[model samples]
Target: MYENCLKGHSALVTGSARRLGRAVALELARAGADVIIHCNSSKAEAEAVKKEAIALGVDATVLSADFSVDGGAEGLIEAAFEVAPDLNLLVNSASVFPSNRLAEVTLGDINSNVLVNAWAPFVLSRSFAARAKSGSIVNMLDSRITDFDHSHAAYHMSKHMLALLTRLSAMEFAPSVAVNGVAPGLVLPPVDMDAKGGAADAQYLAGMASGLPLKKHGEPEDVAKAVLFLLASSFITGQIIYVDGGRHIRGGE
Candidate 1:
């Protein structure tokens, strides 16, 4: 369905070295777009993804930057433009997921979460909108933004603000660029998750999905497909597509 829609288009995907970010980057390359894969410390994995993209006959570049600092997001954007000045798509998929209950959360935790998950996407979106010829931006959000996750209070709040930013940016950058978000539920857990933690998260997500009409957990590609739709659709903007196996409809059931 995305054939030739992205031909000759250039895309920059932040935190795209592995997992969902890598999946999205490869998917875009498969659809005929040159890709800039951004990573923090996954240089080898990023290069692997780049090789895969090159095998698909698309130009690929790997960029490394820590998006958790004050100026990291802008620096990433500037680096991307330096590689491909006429960039057409930006994917804000890089994020920091720290687990801390509200009672124990510190100012440092809150600031770090907000900077990486919320503010970085906002700054990168604004930067892309200003320089893009005709561009689209997809922000990676979490379904937990709607339902409270007590263990990840700060992270949840940061994603909540990102959802708002997606809407407001859609209005602010309208008629020039399209801004939208994809909120994925239980696609992939953090790399550091232990067996117990992974199983617990999986069970929780499965329980949530059981009440949904789809009755299944989602995959990263499911989210990527929704993103490709947004990029291809000429009229869609300022929207949040939940690729969560309909879990959002359960309303925390």
Candidate 2:
């Protein structure tokens, strides 16, 4: 579907060393965009992704930035522009997914989550919008922002703010650039669960999928395709596409 729409375009995908971020970066490269893959610590994985992108016949580079600290977002964007001076697309896919009940959440947890999940995206979007000749931005959000995930209060609240940032940046950027978001549900479990070989987590996700209107769990590819649509649709902006197996309509699961 992308075809030559993204040919010669340059994109930056934050937290792109692995998981959904890596998936999105590779998809963009396959669609003909040169990619800059940013990671905080996964240098080896980032290089592997870079090789994959290069195999697609597009320029690919890896950059590392710790978005939890001050000036990290600016440095990431700067590094992207250094790789491709005419950068035109940015995906704010890096985030902190900390699960904690309200009573147990510490101030440090709240600050770190907000800084990485909400503040980094907003700051990066603002920086890109300011200097972009003509570009589009897509923010990665969670479906839980619409419904509450009690155990993940801090993460959900930060994403809720990010959803708002997506809309506001769309308006703020205006005719020069477009801003949008993709709110995904159950595409992949949290990294911790994935690491533990947690069959129960998989079962729970499958059960949730059965409840969805689509009767299936989504994959990163679903969100990637939606992102390509937004990037190509010149008339669309300030929109949030829920690639969540219609779970948003069901209110959860």
Best by TM-score: 2
Task: Name model 2 segments beyond 4 Å from true.
Answer: 194-204
Tens digit per residue, CA lDDT, model 2, 1-253: 5776799899999999998899899889989999999999999999999999999999999999999888999898887787898999999999987679888988888888889998999888888888889999999998887777888878877888899999999998999999999988878867655434468767867877888888988888888888888877888999999989887888852
Global lDDT of model 1? 0.88
Per-candidate Cα RMSD to the true structure, in Å, reads 2.2, 1.6
How well does candidate 2 score on lDDT at residue 146? 76
Which consecutive 10 residues in model 2 have the weakest lDDT in total? 189-198
lDDT for every model?
Answer: 0.88, 0.87
- Candidate 2 lDDT at 94 equals 93
How well does each candidate superpose onto the true structure, as a TM-score?
0.93, 0.95
Per-residue error (Å), model 1, residue 132: 1.1
| Weakest lDDT window of 10 consecutive positions for candidate 1 | 189-198
* Per-residue error (Å), model 2, residue 194: 5.0
